[model samples]
Target: MATVTTLAPQAPQAATRAALRTALRVGWFAAAVFWTVLAVREGVHHGWPAATAALLFALAPDLALFVGLSEAPRTARGQLPPRAVPYYNAAHRALVPLALLAVHALAPLTWPPVLAALCGWLAHISYDRAFGYGPRTKEGFQRG
Candidate 1:
């Protein structure tokens, strides 16, 4: 006797969720490009200080890794210490820099360096999200 087997179909909910995730990733990548362009434009127009600020702020988010150095026992390989999760999440959130940019725009004196910093920060956040990296859980692992 011959037996025929059919592949299991993915659930509708799962397919919808997957499509939404892909859409979000695409949006993030587009935001990354937008922020990067703004950062480079400000940096080039405003000279070294703006450029320097952009470079430094772009890398500043990962500096949260130092937050729990003294509480080393809570950390493990490929994970952050529980103490650092809050700091990491705060640093990685796009809202923080967005707020800063709004404030800068409304301030009496707008500074190119501040604009560069905000753009750089947003670019970093956007790129991370675009590449599937996001805030950690309270237990310090990447959220699913």
Candidate 2:
């Protein structure tokens, strides 16, 4: 029942924050392509096992925005409680994976699987951001 002051908070109520269904589908396809390319590249260099592990991190974070128990907010329509908006934004943020990358770069871990997973997160976020899907507003709408 919570709602943001705006359509998605970042824009006015009249803004076209909702993407058309067809556009959503196409955006998904683009995301898949983005994931595939990165996964493939990781597989080629690190082997399938690493790629497999990497896949674990791939869509999970982004998916977390939309997943909730019956009483929780539904991110699909950006209908989460106003207080929960920050959680969705955190899930959609690139800070964690980027931080991992920075740490890896500075520390140079020998673990390929960990690095691969980090890459997957980066790739997934990249895909979503690339196609205009971003953190949801409390009003259950995206700024697309």
Candidate 3:
């Protein structure tokens, strides 16, 4: 005969929601500063429309994310579920380019939108990863 012992499993701890939020805030600030500097330089080179469009397009994705996330329940802030994030992220990522592609086709294919979209996508990934909301783990909030 052998004696058996088992330890109770630990409860799931809350995700590092605050850290994720901080990261997003900081990331956006940094991106903003970077874009401002780049815009000033581009404006000097290419003039106002180029610079304005660059900044606007760069901010579009973050703005879209903010709008969507703001509508979520208060409890769902930093812990947005992976399933929902991809949808929001995908839409945010696709919006400007898709619109550009639809409207002018070739004009928006230039550098500014592409660069801004890339920055936005990177920001989205960083925000999600900061909150531990990757595809493999169901660590964040879930929508019914």
- Which numbered prediction scores highest in TM-score against the true structure? 1
Whole-model Cα lDDT per candidate? 0.93, 0.68, 0.49
Q: Model 1: clashing residue pairs?
A: none
Model 3 residue 68 distance off true place after TM-score fit, in angstroms: 4.5
Writing each residue's lDDT as its tens digit, candidate 2 over 1-144 gives 997684446555335434454566576667657656766677678897778867877867755544444536334543665555676677667788778778887884567777778777767776777666778766646765
Which wins on TM-score, candidate 1 or candidate 3? 1
Q: Candidate 1, TM-score vs. the true structure? A: 0.87
* Candidate 3 local lDDT, 78-99, one digit each (tens): 5654445555555444344446
Q: Tens digits of per-residue lDDT for model 1 on 1-144?
A: 999999777798799999999999999999999999999999999999999999999999999989888877656776888888899999999999999999998999987999999999999999999999998999888889
Candidates arranged by TM-score, highest first: 1, 2, 3
Best by lDDT: 1
Better of 2 and 3 by TM-score: 2
**Model 3 regions more than 4 Å off:** 1-36, 66-71, 81-84, 91-144
Better of 2 and 3 by lDDT: 2
Evaluated at residue 123, the lDDT of candidate 2 is 73
